[model samples]
Target chain A: MRLKMDFMGLSLKNPVMVAAGPWSRNPETIMRSLDAGASAVVTETIAMEVRQNVRPWIYSKNEGYQNVRLYSDHALEQWLIFIRQIKKEGGTVIASIMAHSPSEMAYIAKSVYKAGADAIELGLSIPHGEGVAVMGSDPDHMYNSVKRVIQSVDIPVMVKFSPHVTNISELAKVVEKAGASGISAIDTVRSIIGVDLETSKPLLATYGGYSGVPIKPIGLATVASIAQSVKIPVCGIGGISNWSDGLEYMMLGASTIQIGSAIMTLGSEVISDVIEGMDKWLEQKRLRAEGIVGKALSNLKSFDEIEILPYKAVLKDACPESSCETCVVGCLVGALEKKNGNIVYHQELCNGCGLCVSLCKDQNFELKWRL
Target chain B: MNIRDVAQRAGVSVATVSRVLNHPDQVTPKTRERILEIMKAMDYTPNWFARGLNLNRTGVIALLIPNIMNPIYTEIAKGVEEVAHNKGYYTLLCNSEDSKEKEAAYIEMLLHRKVDGLIFIAGHLDPDLMTRIEETRLPAVMIGKIEGNWQFSAVYTDYFEGARKATAHLIENGYSGIAHITGNLRFIESAEKLNGYREALKNADIQINPKWIIGGEETIEGGYLAAKRLVRNPNPPEAIFIANDWMAFGAIDAIKTEGFRIPEDIAVVGFDNNRMSGLVEPKLTTVNLPVYKMGLTASRLLFDEMDTLSSTSESDEKADQKQQIFLPLTIKVRNSCGHQDRIKAIFGE
Candidate 1:
């Protein structure tokens, strides 16, 4: 399987890159990820000034994760040294930087470029970084800031967009107009995570960035939208834990994939698993990554353009063997019922939405597209 | 009115007026009375900020705790309050709810208010907290144990030793099949207790069953759920050593729900001899951590540091050194571990 792809004008060994996060906070972890077959390691977001992180910064839920992490506490000089060392070791390095202004970003970008970074990643929308981080909502500011960094640095610059933007595609276009080499969408979603009902205090006591399996839809949507709008490559991020998710993003037009939450939750070993999964899938499909990229976009349809075919739920033989009534209880139109220890479908009441087909845990219901 | 206005009306020097406000007995009775009368006439209230600025002490300290609802912390807060009140100082109780942001905010607010000192009852020492305390040169003490060398004075019970003693007591009671229910291991204290439990089992030459040891949230529900899993095991332990009394209470409830009698079917011992420990049925046998005394000791340490800081221009050398006070733990023998039953048999029921 040919996994290599051109991301931001740089030839990557694979489409999988370790996104800028705690996993890439230190030289050791960055090396670990690169050794585990990550195409490139994006360093933890660095800024001109240092920010202190909260204790117990990472909180994991059943569905996703939440963190109050601000940015890299390492000094810019320390990171520059790390980047220089990594580049000397023949490892690809993409420096991630966060700044409030275009000048600060451009200055950091120039320093990073001198330090031997292959590319630059602009961190614009850290959830807790309201004033200090980039304003993803302001397109003009984003375009200007991205443009300034691109102009100052000779390396390829990828603008990371936040999910909080009203029109993510429009923001992607604004950055593309500024000559951004690629787009990484989406950054962690802004969330409060949860609350302690007993104390009436929020779990983190403040808003934090949320990531993991739950936010994959939001990520795919942003990637699909941005890929459709911009000419540059789309790096799908957020909630990508498995290779199938990586494949799904690639099919939706993301040329590259960034893994952050999965690495944080499952460890860096998942990087190899994801790469292997993507390779094995490509091998089975007898296709290269470029063939799959943007393949789904051609078939993509708007809500009104979708062809809604009429269908009806039909009970399968396994319905009697399993006592599960999930579909019966979940059916909104009262189309499904359990009668005489077997599922009975009322064809007359069924709207042919085929929700039961997905809800049935035992594969006890099937959707007949043409009744 | 300002102090100068009161001084002008009283026809006394500002020093005499200041003396009357602070050390009234030092001033002559007639002079003090005159100063007081004029001050009342001028509606004069000494400015708090100005007073604090002059003395370089706010007569106020702040206590930051991870959670207020926990009884252990509430007891510590009470002890701190008692010491602060006796010293003629007020304490600002700030609950961080285990959030570093909230803790940082509270520290910032206390610093802004010119608090004389701070007492932190944190599970873990946040690096930012230590950095801020050092940067400001503020007098502060911690009522917890954190890994590595830190500058702040700390007052904590030897949780490892306490847990070991608790587990050893259960062993002495002739229970070899012992299970340990620990608090969240993410915390240093919980990890220490778990180590202590393992050490005790190792000393007794009993094989440590990994399945017997369950990690739980430091709450009653966490204990209940952990205990539920333990009792449902094919080979449940004859005795269980819980990390804290709150969880022990929950474990006891869970064991009872499983139709097991205390100390007869399964014996249980807990750490932290909380007030309710004695009141609970079967009176939990537990390690008595001097939590209140820890609070009192920590506050005293902070006060002393504040005194040292104010008295000496060269206190930086002294403040750089770490001050640690390790409190001793005692085991409260009770019926939960079936020890009191032996005492009752030896004497009278």
Candidate 2:
């Protein structure tokens, strides 16, 4: 199974790194996560000054959790001290730097590297930074910011990019061109979780970064594009809750996986199970953690590049005398006809897209496989 | 020149001038134009303080519902509007369409419009909503919503008791095996109804067959398919207790299509005494829900809180605590659950 992995030039015991968030804010918290089986840990996005947070800074609903905590509240000196302590304890710590400008970011990067952090992760994806206005998505700002950190620090510099952009792949390429050692695909998208009809205001009222199980599809898509577009490794992070999610990220070419929200919800204990499950799965499939990286990338192709297959919907069960007529109506190709409930599959019309199969999977009009 | 001078110049009443200025829809186009022209000619300006004094009350309450198309929701809408009208308040009805995104957008727009209060017909209070309610300091009432043990200011019908009555009635009619059709058990109301069905069977000392309890979609088609499945089974139930009226209609149609005679072969009882209850061939026997009353009472609660909300000196954190309101339910027995004596009398004659 061999769970040992490497991110950039730094060798990691495993691929799982805790993303820079509230969980990784303090030295004590980061150390606790390391002890909980995280191969590497990222310090929460730290800036030059400590910012005071307001009451009720987080909102959650059926979709996801909206976080308004933009950056670390700890002073830069405090973070440098924490990094030194964590490094002395042999923790694979990655200091996260967020500053007002490239010069400030370069200064923080130099300080953290001097403090003996294994690496540094740039907070270039914050929707809104407390001290520094987030201009991370701007190509000029991202390039200048990453270039400063890269020139200042000898350690691997990973840039986490926000998904709130028109072309994330282009953004990833810009950071990579700036000499970023790796890319962390997806910072939370600015989202309004829900609204309080009672108050006539947005749930949080302010646009907040959203992350959870619901944001995985978009996050994975970002990871795939960045992995395919750039030469540097991609650290897939966003909506990763467990082992399966971690595996999915690696399969999509994430050399290292970062977890944030799942650890917050499931607690530090889930770290062990995730690593263990990944270990067991890799062994059961006779695969290595590094080998699985980009295994699914070959399958990630453009729409025009895909090869269409020919097949028709087949009926397995006895048809009803009178149907709800769901599959017949759902078929975009008009390949299905239901008289009463008697199904007549138009074999020639089927393209094997299997839209009807999904629609009728658990319904009265349970369509069979594409044959 | 002021608004008074404009009214004098236009040969119209001051009220007409005010109406054209504030409430233009109430003024005819001809009168509105004349007043505007007179004001322009006189260079008349309404006193800023006087305008504030005129439209003192915002008097707008946002009523957010899951779907306006749902008959039950429409009834609740009528109820909210009726009560709001009595209070000299206008209800801004917004259909969230059961989506959290749409709900959030409407809530923001309504809040920006300075709604005096809000009423949500939500089954679950999103934690985000809870925070927004706290931050805005607006009096809000929830209608027919409950999540876990946390009770909100909700007006929900006693679905369990109503369902128990329906099931008990079928038991009383000498129907041994009774099947209950319901929406997904994820919903609090649906689960409550199911529990009532189970309890009724338990009280009657009859074994509850798991297979007979069909979990169907909350639609007419779902009910039809589920009813067909139940009837085609080897040991079919003699009577059915459908959770809602719309689905009950479908079930009745399915039963008829299956060549079953009402009461003689099978008996059916539905919930929600909707308009279509009496329109069908054999009228539906159902649980009469206080739809209008639920909405009316919930709105009344919001109105009462609106008083305290307006006078913030009296309200504190405790004022935001949710209050749960449970309304009573009654059975509306019709021809669908055909009385044996009545059926016999009709056929015998």
lDDT of 2 by residue, A1-371 (tens): 28888788989889988988999988788888999999999899876445577557788776478987867887554566677677778899988887645755776787688778888888867764321223566888789889988877788999887777777778888988999999987888777788789988987746678898888888898899899889999999989888999999999989988888888788988788889889999999888999999899998878999756545566656555464577788888888787655788777787666677677754433333454
**lDDT (10s digit) by residue, model 2, range B10-34:** 8888888877765453454557678
Per-candidate TM-score against the hidden true structure: 0.52, 0.48
DockQ for every model comes to 0.01, 0.01
What are the chain A TM-scores for all the models, listed individually? 0.96, 0.88
Docking class of 1: incorrect
Question: What is candidate 1's lDDT per residue for B1-349, written digit by digit as tens?
Answer: 6888888888878888877765443454557678888777778888878888889778788888877877888888877876676555789899988887887888888888878888986465477777787688888898887766567788766789889988888887788999999987877888999999999989999899999999888888988999999999989999999999999999999999999999899999998889999999988888877677677667756765775676556633454555565565667777899773453222211
Interface RMSD of candidate 1, in Å, is: 28.7
What candidate 2 keeps of the native contacts, as a fraction, is 0.00
Cα shift from native, residue A259, model 2 (Å): 0.7
